[model samples]
Target: MIKRLTKHGNSLALVIDRPVLDLLEIDDQTPLSVTTDGKCLIIAPAPDEKRRQSFQSALKKVNKRYGRALKKLAE
Candidate 1:
């Protein structure tokens, strides 16, 4: 299905339909993370608390193992 961006003040907003929202398990109370890959946009339900913690922990270990050089490259 196709969606168009509607005018929202000075910005554009895409209206997500109900079926897509349901498939993503996005309830009104849940938050979403919005990001872009330069060429495209991504919208997803935020990871749960446990999963977020695990990801941050794993990232710290990896950064420590790689030292500061890898982090510099990311910048």
Candidate 2:
């Protein structure tokens, strides 16, 4: 697919439309990490550190809650 760059101040910006944004599940506030190989540009959603930490915290609690039962089952 071809895309045209629009002017954003002096620099050009590639505008991503709603369909593409919806497909990626990212919105305007979502942060992205951008990089490129010699031939192609790679774009992806950056890790949400806060969300990761919260999920890890929740998982640790679940493990703590069930650790004894899990250990007994293993044995």
Task: Quote each prediction's TM-score.
Answer: 0.59, 0.64
lDDT of 2 by residue, 1-75 (tens): 799989999999989989999999999888999998979888899988999999999989988999899889999
Provide the lDDT at 70 for model 1: 92
Query: Which residue pairs collide in model 2, if any?
Result: none
- Residue 66, candidate 2: how far off, in angstroms? 12
Best by TM-score: 2
Q: In candidate 2, which residue ranges exceed 4 Å CA deviation?
A: 51-75
TM-score of 1: 0.59
User: Which 10 residues in a row give candidate 1 its minimum summed lDDT?
Assistant: 21-30
Separate clash counts for every candidate: 0, 0
Q: Each candidate's lDDT (Cα)? A: 0.89, 0.93
Which ranges in model 1 have alpha carbons more than 4 Å from their true place? Answer: 51-75
